[model samples]
Target chain A: MTELFDQVRERVRRNVPVVIATVVGLDGSPPPSFARLGATLVVAGDGPSAGSLGDDALDRVVEADARRALLSGSSGLRRYAVHGAGDGRPAAAAEPESGGLTEASGPTLAVFIHAIEPPPRMIVLGAADVSAALVRVAKVLGFRVTVCDARPAFATRTRFPDADDVVVDWPHRHLAAIADELEPCDAVCVLTHDAKFDVPALVAALATRAGYVGALGSRRTHADRVARLRAEGVAETDIARVMAPIGIDLGGRTPAETALSICAEIVANFSGTPVASLRDGSGPIHRPTRA
Target chain B: MQDILDDIDRWRDEGERVALVRVVAVEGSGPAGPGAAMAVSEHGEVSGSLTGGCVEGAVVAAALEVLASGLPRLCTFGYSDEDAFAVGLTCGGVISVFVEPVG
Candidate 1:
């Protein structure tokens, strides 16, 4: 069990996807000796599985469930009948069992399936002053941050040493090339002050499933960009997904404060939490006291 | 569990027995959900946490007991539980933790 746990730790450290399936409960006359309670199995993304849950049939069933859980990015307890007609067969479906301690009819075994996914990516465009701070803040928040810019001089690794990746390329082209890799957990932030860069970059971002698509700009600049987006035939709903004049109404100044707001907004977006953002409020973005 | 790996490895290098505690199920408004884990070394060192620091001391005691008895058991801490006492979580939710010695 310790060896299995060590494998799980290694995979998590390397940001590799893994699933840990542990036999948490057993109810019956008696369980197999090898099927001792708390027997755990660690399954990696593309390698051999470590440990087992005693019986081969039980291990097979749990392994399949672990893979599904890993893909869905969820953890939960699942119960199976120990002596059903088709005992040890693939579970047809995992119904939400009520009461953590409620035992099902016949002998039952409960396995807790926990999936560990790689940290999501935060692709920040422009590599400008704000981008540098945003990259740092996002890294602190456990995101695999990538700083991208069209200018070679500004996008170097030295400028954003904390970022996981520094790519010097046109914003839209870079986003499009890696669009398929973006998951709903990922984010895209357009920090370029220039419309030429922010527009196409946002267009590409909105086309993907990236959960948070934010652009840094003033209200007038966002209005102009909206007109350009409408002219380019981007749908109204898709355009609405863009968080223009991004960041929460933290009334903060400086690049670090703005970066905090943006990262906080991304977290709020994913968590389905409503926050008071500057984009939604009419008052001054920063308080006079701070200035 | 991932957060406490370094400390666990250090303890293991020194050949100390350790108990791993995992939150298997959380009931209603619990602070931490399933898969939240913590480890307690034989030397009484603890790493990670199951809740917002309400029941960790009791959990460490449970871990030491498990290490001494060499037994795996399930312990629950919450407001609605019959055993709710000084060590229950203040969050008004129930969390069932499985404590077992690492082999």
Candidate 2:
């Protein structure tokens, strides 16, 4: 029912992880399948399940699998062997974690478990020109963007209208408060080119599981920042994770262009793609200027 | 589903029964990955997409069927050399879609 989908949308709006297990396939080889193709079970983390796979027993089995999919934060297909047994479906009765490819005995219920996770976070640690630009791009890329700066004057909602959150707290403290929530999918961009703001921000950003940690500055500034980080006793590996002189070498000078370069680096880094410069690659880079 | 929420909400506001069609599996070279979904109203109005403008017609047909029969169905769309005029993906990739009636 739409109420089930509403529950899913509500949970997603609250940034709570949920899973939708829909019966995508049903094999009636053994006759009388408990699930119909298109039957659905909406499973929320630690919440009551909405809808059903046409059987209480099968719903329990799918609920468990949905919880696991929520934990893994991936959407894919899963399968459970249907049996006219007890009031509940047995997890061990099937592969339990099969990828819907198992040729189990009797009929089978193939459910596509889709995980609805909160959008990945992008915490911009500065509310300057570049920070505002970065928030715009990050939002377009489906990140929950937060722009944090200590100065209330700079970090106004009017300044970064696209940012989801505008915080006037010290950058490092703001990062520390939300550090536990940050995962490898999140990113922290230190657009504060100042040593006072950026140095401590980098220290906190590196400690978190945030996948992309970058500081904006020129080469000379990056070298100085690195030496300062070393002096602060930060580990070499942690220091190395900092993408100072942030962004790929697109050679663009505008704030928007810089933001693109930085976000490009973030995307490339998180996707595990080599951040190789285009100049390093040999071959035609363009489509011959439209002939 | 999130991508098509606005339309789903509008259709729901207008008292329309919607069939939710989701891509459960993609064999190879699918333009959209698994979880790609489309919401279809009982009247065949559609929102969102599953493939690169290829299999939507078939999915809408299936969604309408699910709404009419009140039973969900699994529809597979892929390139079939023998069936010319068949509704399938132009790209050789196969996708398994689940079409269900949603309140």
Candidate 3:
């Protein structure tokens, strides 16, 4: 038990993609009681699981679902019927549980598997003051952050000590190298206002299936960057996906305020929430600052 | 859960038992989302957190019970109850916690 806990702790600390399958509920035959049902299945990409659901067949089914949930980074309740028709009903209600019977006569069980995946990655493409602020805020909000920049001096450990990874390379080049590793839950932010860096980064980021891609710039810079990306053979439709002048319209001028705006935009993008600043809205900050 | 791994590992290595509690679900406005976790060692050392200090004490007690019984459980706390004297989230949000023996 200690070994298993240690392994899980290591994986979680490293931010490796993993899922914990817990049998929350069960029905029929002998319902896996809460004491017996609390088995931890450590799931990684197409790998063997550590724990079981007390039955091999049940483990196989839940493991398959856990893999899918891990890939999608989704968590929800799922029910599988025991000694039933696999429709989440009791065995007698569907078909009689018969040993060595045909497929139609097989019994099923209802097990609720909840997949707990790690937080998403947020890759910030500059180590500027705004990036520093954004990194702190993003960390607080449970994002695994990676800081990237072409200037090694700027993208140092000191600049982004809280970041999961700090890469000193051209933003586009670094992204291209690791594009295959990025998942849909990941995001890319091009905070380098310089067209030389921002334009190429935006072009490369748009190619990925990353959930959000935002570029930092003024209106004039955004227009120019769009033209440059188009010239580089990026389609207009693809270009439309980039959130230029990246952030909610908070009229934020300070670095910290701007970082909040950008983070707010990212949250809105992920949650499908309407983009509105606190000043523009009437709601309390942080659910009335819960005690 | 992720943040307190080092502490959990060190404590477990020293032959200390640990219990883990995770926020599996939440309703209304929650300070932390599902998957937020906290761990308590048999000796009463604690790390990580499931709530904004509003429910950690309750969570620690619940975790100690889970460790002793070796039975995982789901615990809920919020402000919607008429029994206002009971320990609950002062934030008015409902949080479901899962407590299990980690070691």
Candidate RMSDs in Å, in order, are: 3.9, 4.6, 7.5
TM-score of each: 0.84, 0.86, 0.78
Candidate order (TM-score): 2, 1, 3
- Which numbered prediction scores highest in lDDT against the true structure? 1
Residue A106 in candidate 2, Cα distance off native in Å: 2.4
User: Any runs in candidate 3 off by more than 4 Å, and if so which?
Assistant: A23-37, A78-112, A276-291, B13-15, B24-34, B43-45, B51-55, B76-84, B88-96
lDDT of 2 by residue, A1-291 (tens): 555777887887788898988776656464334555667788887678889878766777778878888899889987676666443444233555466443655667777889978889999998888888899989887799999999999999999988889999999999999999999999999988899888999999998999989888766777798899999999999998888677777757778987888889888988799875332333432224332
Provide the lDDT at B90 for model 1. Answer: 82
Clashes of 1: 0
What DockQ results do all the predictions give, each relative to the true complex? 0.58, 0.63, 0.31
**lDDT per residue (tens digit) for residues A22-118 in model 3:** 6543344444332254666677764567876565666676788778877777665555544433345422322213221112212233333345567
* True C-alpha contacts between chains kept, each model in order: 0.57, 0.69, 0.31
Query: How would you order the candidates by lDDT, starting with the best?
Result: 1, 2, 3
- Please state the interface RMSD for every predicted structure, separated by commas: 1.7, 2.0, 6.0
Pairs with steric clashes in candidate 2: A1-B103, A2-B103, A57-A89
Candidate closer to the true structure by DockQ (higher is better), 1 or 3: 1
Model 2 docking tier (incorrect/acceptable/medium/high)? medium
- Docking quality band of candidate 3, CAPRI definitions: acceptable
- lDDT of every model, 2 decimals: 0.82, 0.80, 0.73
True contacts kept of 1: 0.57
Over B1-103, each residue of candidate 2 has an lDDT whose tens digit, in order, gives: 5557778878888999999888888887878887887999988999988897888987888899988988877777777434425766777777878888876
